[model samples]
Target chain A: MGDLTPEVQRIAGNLLSQGQVDLVLGWAKAPSNGQSVPACIRQAEQAGRLIFDQYCIHNLATGLLDHRDSSERIGIFVKGCDSRGIVRLAEDGQFPRERLYIVGICCPGMKDQAACDRAASGLFGETAGDSELAGKCRQCAHPNPVIYDELLGDQQPPFLNDVRFSDVQRIEAMGIGERGEFFSQIFSKCIRCYACRNICVACNCRQCIFDETRPQWVGRSTSAADNMMYHAFRAMHVAGRCVECGECERVCPAGLPLMLLNRKLIKDIDQLFGPYEAGLSLEEGARPPLSSYRVEDPDPFVR
Target chain B: MKSFAKSAITVVLDRLAEQTRTYVPMRDGVTSNFSPWSERRASDLALNSLNTTFSPKGIVFPQTERLYDFAVDGQRADISGTHAETGENILFGARACDRKAFAALDQVFLRRGYVDTNYKARRDGLTVIGRDCLQPGPFCFCDSMGVDPMGADGADVLLHETTEEFGWEPLTEKGQALTLRLNDLLTEKELIRPESAGCRLEVNVAGLPEKLRGMFDSPVWDELSTFCMNCGVCTYICPVCHCFDIQVMNNGSSGCRFRCWDSCMYPEYNLMAGGHNPREGKRDRFRNRFLHKLEFFQERYGSFGCSGCGRCLVTCPHSLNMVLVINRLGEVKVDAS
Candidate 1:
């Protein structure tokens, strides 16, 4: 139940009052009980609203993308997943790295919102049980933020295992028709709310293709065929830049397994090209695996 | 009024399903939606646990529906309505919120000047079998907006769920007609009226719709829209979010005009052909969404559009539901000196 909220407030207040940042973005208690939502604090007095806990599931760094060009620096609280979003933003040169003041919090895996709803009656402390944790957190490779301007609690060790990829392998093991049906069923559940796209830090575009109507790509209908095209195209768009944040799947109202496509691409990148982890740091080669490819890369189709 | 045991309730549904295509709450993977009942795909009669996800408004006002088809060229422009497979559909286990939404939709589609034949064709023979919600879900706030989770607003027949039995009260001609068919399945069980759980979250609905009339130019929209993702989840999940866009699917020689669900939250919803979008900012769009639900619909339909199903509470990525909006706006000093 203990979180470093006091510490977070102290740092954010210091940053905002001393003119270190114009805005301090973090999670705050939601209007409802046992829930938290992303908050944007512009004043030092409002800095008290900043919170860090198991309920801080949103990737705040995505919203920070719009504020990148501001004259004054912006302070952001980042988890392992959110910090990766920062790296992805930096890699694309979407924002100046100097403009950000990152306050990283070591995450002890988070729980699913639905599971949290189910457990709301328990009235208990943070429990790190596998069943309670989000699907992404269960197979997380990084519990500590890969990059941060300031670190909060004691760093937790990363649980490095590749069991998550077997999901992609399991799909790969399926016959083509079965795979088609599998994805069709998932995509059909899409309400086309664009929660996955809107919540994504990597899906930073001035105008999303789905929203464009001049030469409309995806029509405004929730048909299964149209939905399939929308997701398939988005997976290709965020292929390499995706930092395994799992925000897409988390934000999905229909509970469609969106990370399956993103992780499948990540798995392909690792196996086909080489082991590649996105958004580790700006110091690491900024280009995502697909953006800057070597000609010597192996190909099963080209042959 | 006659009550039947939990097991015998299936007998009633089975008899109904024998003739009419019964739309029952069935488990659909991670969520539950109304699916047609069959022998293999039985209904999830644990209606308390299984939510409609959104209300059953889609049954009347569908997500996307084709109006008619016209010629690609100007020649032979006879609008041909799609042939609908004619059959009666019964929405079983429909909640009061869902039934209220059906009535609200009826105002728009049936009672309106130009009755929408597309909606009318489907709604004419349709019937609602209502069930009382004992334990309301995390997001339910139906009672605040003049809706009872236990009341039968649009239902022909109302069923009260208890631990051991379901008390049936046939309300309309449809119910009495259907009851005649369930002659053998009927049982003489005691009608137990236990206390029902309704929406916990409260909003001040009195004089509020009128209050919203002058507050369109308010600053509260800015604060609310700051966290708004402009996603259609809220509108789609909403029971009475009935704004839909008219679009035409064009092939070279053939095309079909259809109506698809649109959100006032989207920028394109207000965009003009002449490149003018009045509600351009997220603030404007956000304000419009609640205003339409509270004020505009009240002006037109004599009631607020929202049924308080609370689908938006659980579904919104950010917890920006009507509860928060109502609370924030209610507290806002409209004439800040």
Candidate 2:
């Protein structure tokens, strides 16, 4: 990737100085431990803190949710995966497109900061050698931003040039009982921390079902049944709307393969509702397949 | 001192497993945490790891626990349930930082005239074996938090790891009994203890709690909580975060009251019955979390709530963590008026 730090700094500084944006959401090197982290700057003078690096893995688009209630205009830096999240939020009516000044980057597959920490700690038996492209970046179908007010860096090739549903296919090949056991094993480790839900830009529900108390939808217990319910519900809920950013899987402390469930739904949705990828377009009245309906849509369950 | 060769760790674990439910830090797939000892988990034993991804607090204060069961009958209520009970168990190979967190937990559950029966039951039956940190991890700051990396005050048995052997020093009756149980495996050898290294990370937490008492309305909180996504990652994975929420699982007329781990980061945690939430915003929740850790916990329990185990550092999806929060707090210029 090109050194877009100067460009990012200049854009953020200009946006803040010109009173175009109330906040500039970007990445900064954490002072305590040199790791790149999502940072926000209100003053143009603080624009020097903005950076773009391989370790800048967090999707800043999720940060937009924090300001949805306010009328504050935000200037945000977005990688390819993160840009989809902006579209996801905008399409869901969580954040208006007018409130955002999206600065898009043609992402050159970033590295996972959490994975690096885990590897350095040697707690997971992972050596430094195992560090590579973040799981989300590896599956990137859109390295170039699908929508942007201003684009930066050279356009890059998608990391996943081959079959996008290869991992999903492996799970589909499993016998019914095997598949059940496979998910059960993953769900068993879940502590129900909801990092996946919280980190996700697509999970922009004003009030999540899990957090509902009047008629508590999902059990708070971290039992296999409850965890399975949570994961399955979330997967189906974001079926067509998922940006395939892999933030859900990346943030899961239990190391659950959440993308498998997501990709499975993506594949099924594609098969059921063909050739559809979510958050790719900002066309007026565009909506996810599940969110919008037609008379000719698949009636597999109806029959 | 009773000593055991590094190669005989499985043998030692097997012996302990026969007598009690032993939880050893072991690698599980891509993460490591305390789990029950078994042949399958034996090969994955990770005693040398800085600290497990998940804390062993669940061993005593479980993530979700059944409080009681209730049934509604015509004009009558039937509440019949057993209090939590447990047999003797061993927490083997826990680090000093994690072991220290038990004290904070004990203060919450077993003090001030309101002893939790479930917590008491588990606390009474659990024996801790804390391992010394000869080499502290980059994120570890237990010393700055007033904990000795080499000294685990609350551990029954303290294990000192050297080049090829472990020096076991029993501090309590439980530790002595455990030492006696594994006498055949442990040889009476004097192993040279390695020099302890300090954590690369350090913060001056001196008078921090006292200082934080007057900074409730400070603008620093607004700046500090800016990028915090308000996720439960920090609280859930934290060794010392001990808040919980109670709920009921209803099936027809019968239900069981269960309490699960709750994060103050959630808005509903402080939501009022009258549809008024005192901590409704992310900033309010974030401020409360750090204040609770830095001020309220210290004022109430006479010790910092955080153990500086650094689980939050490694696990927080966003880079918001205790170290950053504390450092930011340190930089705040307070007013005396």
Worst 10 residues of 1 chain B by lDDT: B42-51
Best-matching candidate per lDDT: 2
- Candidate 1 residue-wise lDDT, A66-147, digit = tens: 5655676889899898999988888887777788999989888776664455233111112124356676676678878988
Candidate 2 residue-wise lDDT, B1-337, digit = tens: 7889888888898899987999998888888889999987677888777788889999998998999899999888899976586678899988888888999999989998899888899999999998888888877888999899999699999998998998899999999999889888888987788879888889889889889988999999988888777778888888899899988888978989988999899877888888899998889999999999899999998999998888888788887889999998998889988
- For model 1, the stretches where C-alpha displacement exceeds 4 angstroms are A31-34, A118-131, A159-162, A283-285, A298-300, B43-45, B70-80, B83-86
Candidate 1: tens digits of C-alpha lDDT, residues B140-183:
67889888888877889888888878888899999898778776
All candidates: CA RMSD in angstroms? Answer: 3.2, 1.6
Q: Tell me how each candidate scores on DockQ against the true complex.
A: 0.38, 0.69
Top TM-score prediction, candidate number: 2
Per-model TM against the reference:
0.93, 0.97
**Candidate 1 docking classification:** acceptable
Q: What is the lDDT of residue B76 in candidate 1?
A: 58
Every model: iRMSD: 5.8, 1.6
Top DockQ prediction, candidate number = 2
The residue-level lDDT of candidate 2 at A247 comes to 91
TM-score of chain A of 1: 0.90
